[model samples]
Target: MKMWFLGTGAGRPNKHRNVTAIALQLPEPETGWWLFDCGEATQHQLMYVPLKLSKLEKIFITHLHGDHLYGLPGLLSSRSFDGGVTPLAVYGPIGLKAYIDTVFSLTETALDYEIVIHELEEEKQGIIYEDGRLRVEAGPLVHRVPCFGYRVEESDTTGPLLADKARALGVRSGPLFGKLKAGEAVTLEDGTVITPESVTDGVLRGRIVTVLGDTSPCEMAVLLGKNADLIVHEATFAAGLEEKAHEFGHSTTIEAARTAQLAGAKQVALTHFSGRYSNDELSQLVAEATAVFPHAIAATDLSMVKIDRVHERRAGQDEISS
Candidate 1:
């Protein structure tokens, strides 16, 4: 899976960054992408990416904050003009349905496609969404408003069939091989039972990615990010501003890294940066985060990061780029 940062600034947009919006490009067989937070001007940011509104299947809002979801109405409206006919499902905290309804009602806007809004219960924590291919778990986060963090887990895939092993075991490359690959035991013409475990490689473990809303470092954050391949945490301030960050219900770069460490995550992407830091100064946040967790990166606007199933374990590596 790949993540495209549409906006990375906190609270408001600046010259360098927009607000907090991220587009997660789903893997194959799924042609669409899932949007994280839809901050102000998020649709404008989408103009620069390869993503399309028609292909947006699911949208997960971390909170009801303006910086997190102010762009929802415009984006949803624009989708109709952009030929987005597929039904879209939006998952968020309570009051979300009312917010969307109020906007659409006041604006007298009509959508060609259906918009399904799911309002999560207050402080509810568990699987919010699940399908045959992916499962999403939501956990309450410590924020000024009712906020949440999401853990997206891809389903484990079957490993490739060992053609050489099957051939050696008198298994022909026909329907018998297909049956064995499908985890069914097949009896060959020679009366040899071939089990999938004996001929195929082990299962390939799926990847887990955690995306958090604006929050102070909390135990729930750790729980949502536990053993995640990548955790996208909000680092709204640098290390020295921990007090200010927490006062605003936000996290410092150090706190984000600590949460990643406590959660045993493989990598951390620090985002939701404050506009006080200039473009060049954003590196300071990355430096502070890397001090506590080596695999930490400061996400920049329009940057893209690829999350691999296999952990690279490289320290101080900047894998994301604009």
Candidate 2:
């Protein structure tokens, strides 16, 4: 799995950044992708991405803010022209369905594919989506509007099949061996009960990624991001501007870092910066975050991060992101 940022700036578009949008792609267990927060010009930004629209399976909206959702209609309409015919799911807060329906009704937009809307209710906290491989959990967040934070968690995979050991144990390569490899107890013809414990490796922890919407520091953010491999939070203001940040229902660089620290996150990725920060100024803001949490990183548009890979944060400047 991998994540790519389409827009990292907050509120509105600027020469430096577009807005809030991130793409999570799962290539192996069948190539598919999910989008988080389709802000203005998000579809245009996808032109630079190598993924196909048909592979886009779901879109997760954090809140109904214009900066986070304005581009959703355009992106959906353009999906038709891009030859996307598969069913797509959109998950968000209660008002999301009404907003989409209103826009489509007003524009009389024709859709070639089915759009499934999952409206998350207030105070609802549990798994929103779960297949055998992956699970998504959404919880209410503190924002001006009814916002949400999302946690994408992968299931722990089973260890490698012990084919050689099975063969050496006088077990033939067939259905019985399959059962043994599945961590099941199998009694042989001689009534020998073979346990899979010794043959398989211990369970490896599944990767967890938490993404939060615009908000002041809150317990929900820490809960959603607890012990996560990555925590993606908005840092709309610098450290000294805490008062302004809270007034706007946002977070400063220090607050974002504190959230990550409190959650025990391996890495903190700061995005959705207010337009006031220049490229150099954003680096300074990253410094403020890193001072608190050494693993803090300031993300930018089109930057890609692989979930299972180890990455180093550069000291002097941001990593090469395009």
Candidate 3:
């Protein structure tokens, strides 16, 4: 799993950054990308990365703010023009469906694929999506609107089959091996029934990623991001701008980092920057976050992060997750 920051600026666009947008790249089988908060000119931002608009599987909107959603109608419309045939699903707070319907209806733009809309109103927290390899959860975030933060956790329970162990245990290439790899008990041709735990490492490992939309520091946000391999939070302002962030229901750099630290996150990436900050100012903003959490970083447009492996263990526990 990997994450790419398509746009990181908050509220509006600047020469160095655009508004909120992120791309969560999952593994093959469900290899397409999931988008969060398509800011204005997001389609243009796609040009900065190796992303295909046609490959977008789902879009999650943080709020109805123009900077967060102005690119939606244009991107959805362009998807059809770019020959996207796969069905696309969009999840967001209420009024999202109405927004899309109005735009598509007024423009009379027909899509080559299906568009599924899920409008969330209540305070929801649960598994919103699961595609064998990846599982997505949604948590209510404290925002001006009924916005949400997403947690994309890779199911570490899908341990790969130990081929050498299977061979050593007298298993061969056939249905038996397939069944065993799937955590099932199988009988060999010689009438020996082997359990999945007998020949496999019996350990499952995968990555966990949490992405928070425009939100203020909240308890639910910290709980949802606990122990995440990556936590992407909106740091819309510097320390002195806390009042601005609170007024807008956004977060400051230190607050974001503190949330990551409290959540036990391995790495925290501060994004969704305010346009007022320059390159040097942004660097200082990152330093503020780093003071709270050493692993914190300020993400820029088109920045990519790959999850190699995560090792979690107590002092006396064994080394794992390689």
Candidate 4:
């Protein structure tokens, strides 16, 4: 899995950054990718990356702010125009469906594919989406508006089959081997039963990623990001702006890092930067975060973070590439 930061500005766009938009690209066999917070010019930013609108499976909106959602209507229209035939699922706070419907009605626009909107209730927290391979949970955060944060947990995979051990136990390399690999016990022609655990390694644990919307430092953020491999938190101000940040329902770099540290997150990607700071000044913001949490980095526009499948839990830092 990988996260692509398409835009990373606080309230508005600037020459240095756009607004807030991030894409979580799943690994192969799952052709679709998920989007989080479609800010203005989000589709335009897509032009620079290899992601496709037709392959966009879901969209998760953080809040109703213009900077976080103004690009959604155009992006949905463009997806249809680009031949998106599959259905799309959009998850967000209440009133999101009305917002999209109003926009489409005003513009007299129609879509080619089905769009399902899930309106999350304020302060309601629980699992929002789940499938065989992955599960997503939502929790409320302390924001000016009713906002939510999501925790994505990938399901653990079965371990590889020990072919040599199976063969030694008189289990032929055929359908029986497939069944053993799937954790099913199989009886051979010789009446010998071979169990899955007896001929396979242990299961491989999956990775967890937490993505938060705009919010002040809150316990909900820490709960959502608990023990996550990566937490994408907003850091709208530098270290000395804690009072101003909390007053506006936002977090400073130090506060963001503190949340990550409290949550025991392995790495934190700080985004949603205020335009007051230029690109060159981001290093200072990162410095502030690293002082609290060693594995923290300031995310910039068009940067990407690769999350490898967790083989074993260890203490280390992940890298973000631009």
Per-model TM-score versus the true fold:
0.92, 0.90, 0.92, 0.94
Residue pairs of candidate 1 with colliding backbone atoms: none
**Per-residue alpha-carbon lDDT of candidate 3 for residues 1-322, written as tens digits (9 for 90 to 100):** 6788889888789898888889887665565898999999999888888778889999988778898899999999899988799999999888999999999999998999999998876597888788777788888999888878888878654355778888888988788878987778988778898887777654556778888888999998998899998999999889878888999899999999999999999999999887888767888998899999999988888899886554444346564655
Ordered by lDDT, highest first, the candidates read 4, 1, 2, 3
Clashes of each: 0, 0, 0, 0
What is the per-residue lDDT of model 4 for residues 63-123, given as tens digits with 9 covering 90 to 100?
8999999999999999998889899999999999999999999999999999999999999
Candidate 3 vs. true structure, TM-score: 0.92
Per-residue lDDT tens digits for candidate 2, residues 235-303, read 999998988888889999999999999999999889999999876787899999999999998888888
* Candidate 2 Cα deviation (angstroms), residue 146: 0.8
Number of the top candidate by lDDT?
Answer: 4
What range of 10 consecutive residues in model 2 has the weakest lDDT sum? 313-322
TM-score, cand. 2 vs. native: 0.90
Clashing residue pairs in candidate 4, if any? Answer: none
List model 1 lDDT by residue over 281-315, tens digit each: 97877999999999999889999998776422224
lDDT of each: 0.90, 0.86, 0.85, 0.91
On a 0 to 100 scale, what is the lDDT of residue 272 in model 3? 84
lDDT of 3 at 45: 88
- Candidate 1 whole-model C-alpha lDDT, 0 to 1: 0.90
